[model samples]
Target: MTSSAENSGQPVFTIIVLGASGDLAKKKTFPALFGLFLHGHISPKTRIIGYARTKMDRPDFLKRISQHIKNTTAPKVKTMLDQFLDQSTYVSGAYDQDSGFLALEQEIQRVEREAKIYDRLFYMALPPSVFIPVANGLKRNCYTTKGINRLIVEKPFGMDLESSRTLSKALGALYREDEIYRIDHYLGKEMVKNIMILRFSNQIFGSCWNKDHISNVQITFREKIGTEGRGGYFDEFGIMRDVMQNHLLQILTLIGMEAPRSSNAEDIRDAKVNVLRAIPEVIESEVLLGQYGKSEDGTMPSYLDDDTVPKGSKTATFAAAAFHINNPRWEGVPFVLKCGKALDQQKVEIRIQFKDMGNAIFHKDVAARNELVIRVQPQEAVYLKMTQKLPGLGMDTVMSELDLSYASRFTNLTVPDAYENLILDAIVGEQSNFVRTDELDEAWRIFTPVLHKIDRGLVPVEIYPYGSRGPKHLPEFVTRFGFERHAQNYSWPETSQTSVAQAVAALSADSKL
Candidate 1:
């Protein structure tokens, strides 16, 4: 762990972003850094240096980054941007060569020479193929021996279990576990970050978060859009390795893990690792793999139709896995994880279904089963749906929710983007929301068997239409794993729409006056 003296007391450091020309860096990395600067999260002495293979002048580089930067309309934000970009510089570099790294080292040296403390952070926004070479180059040519040095690694860590382990071992040889931050952006989400507080702080939930009260848990990731010209890269990782293994699995561990011993990063991470270790390998029968086909109206193309994706490729764009934990708290509960591209909607959420009521007051219209849902995107919310007595009625029950919707409920505050929160966490040396090496090991161990079977053609990928809900067999798959479909249709109340309508009405009234 990095000491307080090394990480704390008003952080002053230089951020080196590798693969600055890549999509991840342009879309997420720089925007996050700008957000931190806009919010006064970093010291004035802090600097940002961009490293990439594509050579460009300072204005060209700034122009590329400007597309992702926002809030420039505000004079204050414009002033901040002027200052932030002034501290920024760019360098063109080959990932494998020493000359570029030597140049990078010189830049770091120049930044350190001007400051009393020398702290550095290296953000690897590049692909896995170049991870080792870049790490080697950085360590050999640019490691800061003066103060703290942290490396932030982005996913897909590796293709499968064996490869993941190999990559971890190689990276381990260069960087200490504490010095490396394996980022799963989902962990930095507003609702996800609130999970610990919601679980441990409230007895209403903490007391009953177990197999006794919970019947089943579903962690789902669905996207509305298909690969859309990115099938070449998507084919390499697929949905399993891309989303389910790291992103969805991280959420499941949080929901199933026992309370941490302390607020320390290691303690929280240890709890998550324990949860992953308790899970048995996902069985072949308990798995469902699917690929998206053309839309019903023939408006969209199938995964195989993409020229970049090999013809007749069997790579799965969707995967559903049912996992059973061996631990006492979650022994009988099934943790069903599902992720896919080109689905009915784009949503990421955790749904915990409670035990069904057996013969309540009105047997004919039995009350809807209780469900606690933590919506992670589109609009952030934590809501519990329970049966309630209908107002001004005789012994009638209807579903109602005790909801906390971020959009309407927290109108004054904006939720920081996941990358922003994560980048800040990395700068401050917080690992609680990041993936630890052991956690990754356990995660890969749990899914490697199924992945192998699919890769070897032992298992076949099912087909679903683009722009439709995932596999026709998804219902049966969920039911097989004990997820009960409710007879009564239910939907959470739309608070955001109502808030917008009310605001519009108020403006209209003011105009009339």
Candidate 2:
């Protein structure tokens, strides 16, 4: 546990944000740092360095990003904003050159020496194209300090397996895996982190979290908004690499992995690697791919229409795959992972399905099943659907949900942002919240073949209208793995849910048209 004393201890650190003026740095990266300050998690002596080509001075940087912070966070965050502003210094420079790195290195030294703490942390918030160059420059210029805890890199880790491997190797040449924090914001989500506790910490889930009692798993990451002017980047990467491989697969690993020997990062990550290593070697015909067509509404942009994207792009906006872990715990059980843009709804979830009623004593006439859902986005909560006796009937089984919502349950506690938790973890040398380099490579390996198929148009990509459940073939997609069109037996409840296999089984039955 991060005790109050630990949280409040040691006030000195030189924290540098390399791409200080970009969208991620302004909207998410900067605000997350402020959140740590607000919650008293960051040390008081932590000095922030904003490094970028943007030739802005301190006053301009603060004024511009302050509004971004406040808009993205609560009004009470102003106190922390003032404190962060006091320590923020703007550095104008390019990422590729040595002069900038030299000047930046001096700035870090000045901060550490002045603040009386020798800790140095550099955060690369720039685009992936610049990650390797900046990383190389940092190794050449900034990694000279002693006893530095860690260096953190944000996600979109790499394009695919090869690129991820190259990036990991490049970074490894700079810092050890433990000394490098690869941030996957989803892994930082309160709900995503809860997956472990929900399974390991609770006996109810721990007992059935294996093949014998559970059936299959579904992890979905969907966004209702189009690329929103990020066409160049979105077109190049698409949903498979952007959403499914890292974020969605990380969630699935949490759900399907055996309990680690210990909760430490290495042990936990080891379990995930084993599962990822067992990805189906045979041709995975069960996978479904797609690009979203323009909406009949005439308001959104289609993949081809986005001028920033290359013409004749084969990139897919939606992707779904049914995979299995060959380990004893989840051997034959299917773990389905799916993600897409322009979805009918905004959602991130894990659905767990328990075995179907072989022969039910109660309401055998009605379909009966039990499921659990852990909803991750829009709102966060858990829901359990099980058969219950209809009040007026003689043991007639009807499905209903028992719900728990974090918003309503934990009053007065606004959970720290994912970046806040992850960044602070990196600051304090806790690797539990960040993914390892091996984990990133393993993640890409699982999807490399499929991604290539998607890129070359070797695999079929069914285009669906914007804001639809995604290719109408989704029901058939799950059926190949023995799942009926979601459990006709259940429907979701409010705050109301997220993801898991049993929950999807219950949901499938109710969703069958």
At residue 312, give the lDDT of candidate 2.
Answer: 79
Model 1 misses residue 66 by how many Å?
Answer: 1.6
Q: What are the models' TM-scores?
A: 0.95, 0.90
How far off is residue 326 in model 1, in Å?
A: 0.9
Top model by TM-score, which number? 1
Candidate 2 off by > 4 Å: 1-8, 71-76, 281-284, 297-299, 362-365, 485-490, 495-513
What lDDT tens digits, residue by residue, belong to model 1 across residues 1-513? Answer: 353236657787789999998899999999999999889887777889999999899899888886888878899999998988888889998999999999988888886777544888999999999999999999999887777889999998888788999999999999999899998999999988988989999999999999888899999999999888899998887888899989999888889889999999999999999998889888788889999999999999999999999888899999999988898898899989999999989999999998777767656346777889999987999999888888874877777899988887777798999999999998888889888888999999998998888888787789999988899999999998788876777877766757766987999999999
- Reference-based lDDT, each prediction: 0.88, 0.78
For model 2, how does the per-residue alpha-carbon lDDT over 1-513 read when each residue is reduced to its tens digit? 232224345544678898998888888888888878777777777789889988988899987667666543555665567778988888888888999988888887787677765666788888888998898888888874454646788888888778888888888887877778888888889998888888899998888888898877878888897776688988878887788778888888888888899987788888887778877632448688888888868776687787787887778888888888888888889888888888899988887877787766544346555678889986788988677667984756577778887765665588768888788778777787688877777777777887777677778889888888888898788767755533344556453223344566778988995
Task: Please report how far candidate 2 places residue 110 from its true position, in Å.
Answer: 2.6
